[model samples]
Target: MEFFNNHTKLFITAFLLFAGLTLLVCIIPALNNQSNNAPLPMAVPLSDMAIKGKGVFIANGCVGCHTQQVRNVDMDKVWGERPSIAADYADIHRTDFWRNTATLMGTERTGPDLTSIGTRQPSKEWQLPHLFNPRILIKESIMPAYPWMFEIKDKAQPGDVVVNIPEEYLGGRKGKVIAKAEALELLAYLQSLKQTKLPSASPQPAFLYGKVGEESDAKPGATKELNGGMLYTNNCQSCHQQNGEGLKGAFPPLKGSKVVTAEDPELLVNIIMNGYTGREKEGYPAMPPIGTNNRLKAEEISAIMNHERTSWGNSAKKVTVDEVKKLMEKVKVKAK
Candidate 1:
């Protein structure tokens, strides 16, 4: 009884018990998880610049809006090549000794999932400007701009990375938008968020409850290939809008545009494959190279083209897969 009543003994005993419980319930399990799960074969650790950029991403509260995980569902297919696995997050560790930032598989998706954004839109030309002002490219965008990550310079220095923002987005400022180190670092981090390829022999996990044959072999009579509507929804609908009436002063309206309604598909295909900047002087932001970046197949490109050419009250000639395939081959050759 005297021993129990001693103040120092009681305090030390209670503290030890509490610490032991925590070690059993929390630390031990965490250590086991880390040891059991290994990063995939092709996974590479983030670069130094990318780690700094990741800090910036957390500081800006990007995780509140954007998610990094792609769930096991057909809808999530647009965000990644496959559903996220435990190994995908095995490499993620604590922010530092003070703070432990777990895998950033955010709960809410106010913005699109970023698991495969590096592959989806790889161009820094599009990314930097969009970060400066998302609305500059996509008028309907609700994402906030990180203007603080950039500096306005009267004349870009020899080593400065100048961000070519459309003039109107500058808010009448008289200077070139130069990407600061933070912004460049953030770009590095965002670009580093690529999905690693799984081993060739390992069977990929099927997205359960999705269209049974979405990726399986095409049936004798059914068309398993994705349709135009789905492709457009996955790619262009974000910028062009559902009705093809792109917002005024930003993206040109595809509803009745001569380009969409044209008999020739060359210019439209080029714009899709390589991106469009001819209208930047007219104040429209440059379109990102969607087809090339996403690595769309010839059939997929043809489907997207036909959707644009015929939708939104525009009646145009449909393009064939072979025709677009030839154009794509030429574009790829030229790119090299």
Candidate 2:
């Protein structure tokens, strides 16, 4: 009782009690967890360029807006295929001994989660202008532009990566905008922010509590027409605007595109499967293969094609799943 009454003794006792609780509740369990013993499945140490880019990411306060974690919830399914596990971050180490800036597992989600951004949004074309000016790509974006990471040059020399910025969004600037080394390095870091997949034997499925038994709502033998608008929003709306009028000089507009309304869907289907960059001469950056990246099915591709063809007052023939499947087969054979 006397010891408890004493301030010094009480302080020491409280400290010891908290420390012991921390060891028991936090440290001991972490040490005993099986995940700690599992090897890093897809963890690779950052490259030199990636390390420097990480520095840039930190210096620019990107952590304030982005989170690297994907919670085990149904809503997070759009960001990643599976819930993140302890092994996903097991191999992450400190940037250096002097700094404690290791592991940018941000708490806030002002921007989208980047746990699998490397696979989700891998295109350099979209990332560059996005970094320069978010409004150019996403009209309603609130992200600040980091124009300091780029430079404007009258003409690009050999071995230069020129950023394609639309004239309307250029803010009356002349000359071509090029991403600096810092920007490229930052891109490398962003591209490395992919989640490590768990072993196939042990899978952690997303927690979809409300969605259970929801599939039974559809009546048997009744074919529900695919919602092309919803499909476009999920897959294509990021690069191409909601109106199908893509960003000028960056992404070609699908509103009046001949490709969208072409009689033969071969070119469009091939582009979706393999991606397209032949329009670079016309100032359009290379289009990433959304179909390949998302692993879209033939039916999904058909829906997207039909949506693009018929939307924005263009009435092209609707594409069928069988036609898309045949085109995909042809693409595979050509690759072989």
Candidate 3:
């Protein structure tokens, strides 16, 4: 009773108890977790360029919009092959001695999860314009452009990599848009943001195991019909959009596009099989070869063409698989 009445003793006792509880509850557990002691997988080490690019990513507030962590949920299946584990980020370290900006496992998903962006969207051709003006590729994208990271040169010098930006997006500025060193570095960092394949000893998640032989016996026509909508959503909807009314001054609308309604599908087929640039006059960014990059089959390309031509108020003839196959063969022969 006397001790309870002593104010100094009570204060000391309370302080000590609180500090002990904090140490037990917070500090001890954190120190004891296996994540703290786990060995970093050797595969995902950051290169010198990637390290500098990570700094640029932090400086540009990319973490504010994009998340590196993919949650263990069905919704996240689109973002990565598997849900992210803490081990996935074991290799990431603090930016400097002064700051604790270690892993950029951002909370907000204002943009897409970048955990597997390397595999999802690997092409530098697509990445450059998307960084410069996301609207050029994604009609409704609110992502800000980093034009300062690039420069307009009258002509690219030897050894300079030119960005395939359409002149319309350049605001009629003359010359080629070349990515600066910083831009290349930033790209390197982005390309490095891939999920590392877990070792065989690690227990694999159920969602990571894809259904085997699901399409092995699928008929060509049936397969095309089945995959058409999904393929469009995955590959085309980003720019052309679901409604197919592409962004003004950036992406040409597919709703009433002449290309979609053309009788001769040769040009369109070639464009898909290869790629198309220099369409600045039509007020659209250059289209990358979705067929080549995504490795779409002849039937798949026909399916996409059929979907685009039939939908969006443009009633063009359905593109045949034979036609697409012939065109692809021609392209292959030309390349050889």
- The numbered model that scores best in TM-score is 2
RMSD list, candidates in order? 5.5, 3.4, 7.4
Model 2: how far is 179 from its true place, Å?
2.3
TM-score-better candidate, 2 vs 3 = 2
Off by over 4 Å in 2: 33-35, 38-42, 96-101, 153-160, 197-207, 210-219, 243-245, 277-285, 325-336
Model 3 backbone overlap count: 0
> What's model 1's lDDT at 189?
91
lDDT of 2 by residue, 1-336 (tens): 899789999999899999999999998897787454664665777898989999999999999999888787877766777777766766666667898786687999999988888878877888999999988778789999999999999999898889988877677989989999999999999888776766678756655644676547678965456788888888888789888998766778899899989999999988887888889899776777678766678978899999999999889999888889999999867756
Q: Mind sharing the TM-score for model 2?
A: 0.82
Worst 10 residues of 3 by lDDT: 34-43
Per-model clash counts, in order, read 0, 0, 0
Worst 10 residues of 1 by lDDT: 217-226
- lDDT of prediction 1: 0.84
Name the candidate, 2 or 3, with the larger lDDT value. 2
Clashes of 1: 0
In order, candidate lDDTs are: 0.84, 0.83, 0.79
Model 3 C-alpha RMSD to native:
7.4
